[model samples]
Target: MSTPLDATAIETIQGFDAEKRYKHLVKEVVANRKIWILIDEHGCVMLNTDDEDCVPVWPNKEFAEAWATGEWDNCKAESISLNKWHSRWTHGLEDDELAIVVFPIQDQEGLVIYPDELDYELKNQAKKQR
Candidate 1:
């Protein structure tokens, strides 16, 4: 599960540009300890961009929930703690050559980054929080 976000907060974040949202996502994910992803019956959703196969992530359930429309309507917003992300996801995604789209919104795909890049950002953000 992920932390609850107020509707107004979600709306505010939704208005931010992709990079700003990505920065906010890194900060909030570090603070909250949860990285939100969307999953359906089969497994995690994968999006293909021109250059990468990306798994989208969000800072909170509200942001993740906002993406679950149309084809992803049946998907559920699930949380992966930062610990699990560091332990499992980074290496797994790196080996699979998958990128991450951070905090995507209805109008745009978010910042696309390599798994290790995201992991590094998360660690740096965590350090700042400390």
Candidate 2:
């Protein structure tokens, strides 16, 4: 079942101009192969269910590893390409009441921050650590 949006997640979404930021963020993620944690409003990691075209993604192995160990209070963390994630998983979400946030893949090492504000080298390093 889809989870509800929480206060922090709502604040994050409302803090940005979604229409203007969505395309730019997508470009940044695709160009850098950056990992992002797709969290619903309630801070639950978005997962790939029976859907074929859509899959949940993390920016790096570190974040994925944490989620796997229930660090994020969840047991599953999956990865998907930015293209499919944007076009498939997130499709129609903009019109729904539910809001999703693209959080930078962060671990104990450091934070990747946001999708639009990612350091390519740092992201790559995190991936390599996996």
Candidate 3:
């Protein structure tokens, strides 16, 4: 199965084509079918996935780290578990704690992961301990 990061790889190669082609590719990811799409400060597509585990989708770990350090703009990571979404700049303004946007992927009505809420969480168990 294609992981959440794989979705971002596809977008990087495809860039932003016409809507018809773009929608077709996005539909392949059940989570992106109804999502908004994440773009970096440079207007580049960031992440795309439906799985709750896959969020805060940045161009890469470097980009995510850069955002955390206030080096970039034009992107934000949303959490399907936290119910909140904010830009990199907004998130950085918070305390030293890693700010994340978590929300319910599925509300009472149905499941929907907004494109703007797209993000890929880094699987660094060792780092979490710090």
Candidate 4:
């Protein structure tokens, strides 16, 4: 995020298809070394897709902040370093059977994946970056 995010970039990124967004998510998350989530005083927010409990994540703060409206109006964007995600989130989400929705927009559900699955992809992406 060295460059300031603009409305045009936000629109373009949000317009990308889920697969494209998923690729962007991996690259950006690895490059930035953090994952963004919406949080309130209690904790991170969760969205439900049928019976599944899913945590929504974004590539950066701006994107995450965009969703902090409606029911999540009180929420704020929170960043989790990749280290913390690996050390705590993976196991905790696995135990809870919660899935992650990567870079989701208001209308579309992004890639819904398990924490270990995302962990694997992110690790692979980071290795490639190195």
> What TM-score number comes out for model 1?
0.95
Task: Give the per-residue lDDT digits (tens) of candidate 2, residues 1-130.
Answer: 1233466754454354434234334444555544455343464354322322222334343434544544455454445555554454444443332233433222321221223233343345446545
TM-scores, each model vs. reference: 0.95, 0.35, 0.23, 0.94
Candidate 2 clashing pairs, residues 3+ apart or interchain: 5-41, 6-41, 35-59, 36-59
Superior by TM-score: candidate 3 or candidate 4: 4
Model 2 poorest ten-residue lDDT run? 108-117
Instruction: Enumerate residue pairs that collide in model 4.
Output: none
> For candidate 4, lDDT tens digit of each residue in 5-84?
79999999999999899899888888989989999999989988876899998888998998999988999999999999
Candidate 1, residues 38-129: lDDT per residue as tens digits? 99999999998999999999888887888999999999999999999999999999999999988888888799999999999999998987
User: What TM value does model 3 have?
Assistant: 0.23
Candidate 4 runs further than 4 Å off: none
Sorted by TM-score (best first), the order is 1, 4, 2, 3
Candidate 3, backbone clash total: 21
| lDDT for each candidate structure | 0.90, 0.41, 0.32, 0.89
Model 3 CA lDDT for position 82 = 20
Of the two candidates 1 and 3, the one with more favorable TM-score, higher being better, is 1
